[model samples]
Target: MPVSPRIGLVGSQGAYGRWLRRFFEQRMGLQVWGRDPVGDTALSERALLEEVDVLVFCAPIRQTPEVIRHYADIAAGIERGQLWLDITSIKAAPVAAMLSSQAEVVGLHPMSAAPKSATLRGRAMVVCEARLDAWRPWLEAFLAASEADCVRAEAEQHDRVMALVQGMVHASHMVQGAVLRELAPDVGGLDAIRPFASVGYELDMAVMRRMLASNPAIYQDIQFDNPHVAPMLERMSAQLDKLCDLVWRGDNVARDQLREQLLERSRDYAGKQSVAEGSYAFERLGYLLADLREPRFISVFLPLDRPGSLRALLSVFEQRGINLDSIHSSRSADGELLFRIGVSRDGDATALQDAVRAIEAEGIGRVLEASGIA
Candidate 1:
């Protein structure tokens, strides 16, 4: 009879720890033990450390260094066949520690939010292969049980992508939060404005809500741990300055040139294929640049009084199966609102028209210019 894998989860009382524990126990049918690093567990860390074949360091990113050092030290004394793993978002530090530990370690980063009920359909597990030949079977089997697809990538590569993915996303949320908070105190008249709900608005709002709900410490860890933040922020600032110059100074030529440059950049980065009329930039499946052929500029106009009106318009698109490739909003100098959506060629243009009509008829929003992807 085959032996079930012995699983040890460090910092089990914490959310991610608990999430992994319950998931493995219920799905993988493994004998699992959890050790709270805070010393809150009934079992001693050492005692629990002794019994597992695989140890997952699931502590928060901030706690990762100490946890990694301690675990590396502990694993040095353990048996040779044990595999050490970490499920933290930031990969470099823990991957280094695990590599130095000589415990046949592999780094894993789960891309999904902690499974709402721990059911892992359509989730992705990124494995930084230290020794895939040795650990692949077990890792594949374990993740398979939870219905997660495995994506193999290098540790540094994973961190690089994450710096853009998680870092940029959370930063956007933070910026939105700041904007919202700045507007909150004077929002007395906001309620009087019509509700402008749209799929894009809901998407942004969802990001905002999730960021608001996340721990500040975690956000700080993400900001500081991502070494890519500085250069990226600088580039973003430069682009903003260019846009400001165009908008405020009436630099049409510069604006047009900048717009073309942006389109060229999008093609270089996202691909040259026209974005389908209704699909989001995210769902644009292909070479990033080759697949994104839409003219790089778009503008949306809405009534100035209701910012939420944008959200309602996006919701209408959702109902009609339209996708927005790139989107941004701003209030015009004359008290009119504008929304810009970059769409794909295959995206449903008729749906966008219907949504626009609905928004206008319901007094939910005003469309200043709705340009279709060429």
Candidate 2:
């Protein structure tokens, strides 16, 4: 079909680039040719510019503007009527460079990391439509396929908001992570700290751990590359210092000022409704974490996708009289569905083992993992 456009990914070896490659070729059924400096068979800039119907810049934040500028210079009016898009976190500069070409351009920010899911179904994606006359319909189609909650904003506006939403939050977590790095050793590492962690701390640690686990360059660039981050960080540092001074003073006047500046002012700024919604969301996350903290669980994979696949798996536990605390489903990296069934650890531990044995023996499902069972 002529409607199906061949896709060109500029930085194909990067995490998001690889994800985009899978998304385009497998999800959208479009042929994707990638050109990455370190990976993929080298595709010439000329070939990519001339051949691919849609060219997406998935390059690193620091390199994106330069890459776009080079393409724009060499395109030489040949870029006319094509769709050029970038998925950089910071938008203004890359969008500006892309605008140098005649192609229809848009800057996109997914508001999250490269996800495990096939599509960004639940994530927010910011769209900055710099140029979009002829390719508007095609762009809409791709956005729809991405399944992201798309919000439109100007390139300058997107950068400003990310300075707070992304940059500020990341810097805070990075600070916490640094403190944890030192204090963790003093307290015998995270395993020792885990028992005393509150719901909020647990949540914060999850964010910090995820940041530490991923590519350091991404976090570094989020801080260093964003122009707005420096001023934002200064404001944050001032507030933190104010808090420290208030605590050190330890007087009623200081306490009142702390309450006013930290609590009352913040609540007023965020609004009662927004604060209420955030609290409710946190409560829900706490409940999910509570369910997951129980170590007594079995992860099973159903080989068949038939009607009774899940029912059969449940029947094993039902017949064994193993009372389940919770049941949750997740996908493997390969997209195979896995069910994590939590059962009462207080009840007969032998019965749980029996269920695992029966599930494998009867071909109900494969026990991918089970606690207290070899």
Candidate 3:
């Protein structure tokens, strides 16, 4: 009978570390050991090195390189069949440190947020193999059991991609949050401005809030620790300056030309075959205009003096299979009631048309406007 591999995890108290520890013990049914930086665990450094067949470092991104270097002597002493891995967002530096180990080393990055469930189905895991000749089969088997898509890439390539994917993206959210705080220092200011915000602005604010609420150290590590982030930020700043210059000049023709150029570039980045095949400037504007003309939602304005009017308006939408995404009712100074109903583009067009015609025919309320695109 074959002996089961003993797995050891460092930084077991962090979010990703806890998730990984649970995954290995419960899902893989393996005997696991853990070492937490702040407290004592079942395994000390010496015990981990001596007993475990596989060791995983799950420390913060900035701490990973140093942690690997600190354990170099112990890792070098591990047997040839033992495996070593580090789960870090930026891979190049830590992968280099892990290469010093005599054990088969591989750098792994889980592309999604922390694991919340037992299975990792439909998630992506990036693998940068350093010296995995002896451990590749074991890594593959574990990933297969977890049902994750294992994508192989070089360490430098992974860090380059993460510079944009994590570093720049998080930086944008942090900037937005900072701008909002500067403009609205009062606690209830954001709430007071919600009614005037557009759907797109609301969505952006929600994402910004989520990002700001997460662990600040994570974002700090991503922006400051990634070697490629500074250059990417410089490029973004240059582009922003160009856009600001074009807007400040107020040259409509020049702005339109710039917009077309941006659209072409965006299509290319999105993997369109050719500029002619999917040119947003030439092909998409017409479709976009047509879509705007299609009714996405109906707004009904009724006099406050009239009763049962709100009920009648809702019945029309209910009978038409129109699901309301949002509904806001506000009263004007003159006692007129403004009711806005948001509907998705996926709803029935004929039903919406008939409902609108019926509402207009009955004169229950005047249709103020229709919003969104089909």
Sort the candidates on TM-score, descending order: 2, 3, 1
Task: Write down the RMSD of candidate 3 (Cα, Å).
Answer: 12.6
Error of 3 at 181 (Å): 1.5
TM-score against native, each model = 0.70, 0.94, 0.70
Task: Give the local distance difference test score of model 2.
Answer: 0.90
lDDT leaderboard ranking: 2, 3, 1
Q: Model 2, 160-195: lDDT tens per residue?
A: 899999899999999998898988999889999899
Looking at candidate 3, the ten consecutive residues that score lowest on lDDT are 285-294
lDDT of 1 by residue, 233-268 (tens): 677678778777777876678778777876667666
User: Pairing residues by index, what is the TM-score of model 3?
Assistant: 0.70
Candidate 3 residue 313 Cα shift, in angstroms, is 31
List, residue by residue over 310-369, the lDDT tens digit for candidate 3: 888888888877886666665443435677676766877777778778887877778877
Instruction: Tell me the spans in candidate 2 whose CA falls farther than 4 Å from its real position.
Output: 303-308, 333-335, 361-363
